[model samples]
Target: MDDPTPEVADQEAPSSGIAKAQPEVGPPLVEMVNVWKRFGQGAGETVALAGVDLAIQPGEFVTLIGPSGCGKSTLFNMIAGLTDTDSDGSVVFKNKPQRDGELLGKVSFMPQKDLLFAWRTVLDNATLALEIEGVPRAKARARAEAMFPEFGLAGFEKHYPHQLSGGMRQRVALMRTFLFERELMLLDEPFGALDALTRAMMQRWLLEIWEKHRRTVLFITHDIDEAIFLGDKVVVMTARPGRIKTVETIDLPRPRGAEVITSPEFIEIKRRLLGIVEEESLKSFASAGAS
Candidate 1:
């Protein structure tokens, strides 16, 4: 399968202007306050997060990056409502405080791995969400088929997971995620497994998709460049028992190409993030060493 290298024409350059720097502006699409999490009650218990506050605006693309043990996935699980915060915290989405499990199957979640089944065809895998949502299999397949070209899997529908490359597999996973059609998307390193060049292509494709679909996104990655390149705001979390260390807004020109990565503006943002991520990464290492 060929990589998705669609040349997104800058037709709407005016509308694609870099978003103005207004961190956490207007009503939040999702909000978490004083969030805390612990794995167990006894001495061996681990604190995954602490006093974490987050607010995401509708249609904004926010990328989260932090240290290895920084509870980034834990926070994602909490937001997905697969797990709730500790008793003292709150998880609110679309203005309502969600109860436990309220967010399951609500927002589309693409985890670290593609999780595509080798037994299923590409079309089958992409349409699984719709099928599970009570749509007829034929109808679900039709919906997925229509978007295959857009997703770079037009003629590969009959192919199984093992038949595809790493980038192709990730695109199928993303197609599945997009088909689910949730207001908010939680993508956890969707392109992490790809090589550097493949990763870049996927990043460009993702931005074009985001521009066309306009879904609010929360992407988690450990790469500072990826975080800054893809986010309206780059959220940095503190080590272990994580807290919101900083939320740096990326005020760069949108419809961003790989060229933006080397621009003075992008470098400035990356430089600032480097300091924070390095500091937290060191803290994470030290914390683990102590334990």
Candidate 2:
């Protein structure tokens, strides 16, 4: 049978002077087609996702935002290969259909919490994935140590997780994810717990690292500003029985600085997204009240 997934054409560059670099022409790195996921059966059953279709280009940073209970995390789980879609839909990775658990080790995933082990030193925590993959402990440690300076943890290698600040712990957690060396990365609200100031700093730091490495990233966030600032495309999901509401290409440009947030262009994009998100949020609230 012929594949029904639509191919995404390369996006044209915006007229703005600081437009983002265009993705190279090719098949999407990952594509989800008519995906539907349901839980339970009969009267108690819930539809977590319905007819969700999304395509992510290689080396693109895509951020997803939606109201609570909108199945954002469920989408992430499907992409991470931790869960599978219902029989009605398929997840295609690099043009091939992926069965359940097939993408488990192919994509690097980081959940909201730092998940650092308190007993392990910062260096050991950072090298955990590599060590698990049978990279000799010494080799993993060496690889991790070299990245400490770049990740802003140069002198804190010997300290345990308990000794580090929340932001520092997240940096270590992210470093570990990077060390896993997967082509695609699935990050679920990695900086959700940090203070505003700290989160802002981490956002910029993350962009620097992302720009340097150019890994294809799929990030989930509740913060609209974070979604706009970090993504080449901001994907908005609807309320329960979630599906993509819109995919707004962020035309704000590369090497984004704090000043970009207040720019006219950024504000305009934010305004549009805010309206869509607000509408979906209201629907979510109404659904909850009725249920």
Candidate 3:
């Protein structure tokens, strides 16, 4: 037997050092199939959604955008089971059809405002969700306390909602939402109430958290720039009696930073999305005034 040549050694190196590739991940964690929803009773009925279909994959961030009265929030309510779908379709979670309260304990929703309890301290407010769900007082306190430093509420834990700034209050609200075991999050304009600078900061902070935790997130925002910046896909809906008009896949690089917003790709996407939104928004406003 003779020693192997350099070429032969090079060929064998990968076999010894490399590992097999992992399998691709599976299907979506949430699916909305041809869902239709309406409000009002009898002849006064108003359709809020018409045959809407959407899907949010595991660990993917999706944003819903549309003109006012296009039923963006109504669609979210259907997914949250706060409202019923009236058509031949369904919302599925983990491949099974979602029932009312099916995700009650597993899903978290952050609304437009901070929604913090005024009387409670920041730490207590953050733990309130767990407390209401029958978790022991000590354990919930422990969990919220552990998250304080990471959440930027370290020394402010004892402060009341009034003592915190708008951004700080929103941070606490987010911490509270994540206090328990929530795999999927639904955020409706979570940062809409913040000022421009604060909102930009929060977006970066939220993205950092999302990268670390990799939760399946469905976020709703009226800001097209925010939608494009944060979403893996931006789902744009038509005006009035909302239905999906377009779903644009965002191919931006990961670990996205503020600088990316200034890139040509980013600017182009922003422009295209703005055009769609403006067109739909004008249509909605015109329709409303005429009626």
Please, what are the lDDT tens digits per residue for candidate 2 over residues 243-289? 77778889988999999999999999999999889988999999999
Error of 3 at 62 (Å): 0.6
Candidate 2 whole-model C-alpha lDDT, 0 to 1: 0.89
Better of 1 and 2 by TM-score: 2
Q: Which stretches of model 1 miss by more than 4 angstroms?
A: 1-23
lDDT of 1 by residue, 1-291 (tens): 111121211223434211122345588999886677888756777888776778999999999988897899999998887898777678889899887788888899999999999899999999999999999999999999999999888899999999999999999999999999999999998888789999999999999999999999999998899998899888888787677777787898899999999999988888888987887788778877888
lDDT of 3 by residue, 229-273 (tens): 999988888787676666788999988899989999999999888
Off by over 4 Å in 2: 1-24
Worst 10 residues of 2 by lDDT: 13-22
TM-score of 2: 0.92
Best by lDDT: 2
- Candidate 3 matches the true fold with a TM-score of 0.88
Looking at model 2, residue 23 earns an lDDT score of 38
Assess each prediction's global lDDT (C-alpha) against the native.
0.85, 0.89, 0.80
TM-score of predicted model 1? 0.91
Alpha carbon RMSD to native, model 2: 5.7
All candidates' TM-scores? 0.91, 0.92, 0.88
Which rank order by lDDT, best down to worst? 2, 1, 3
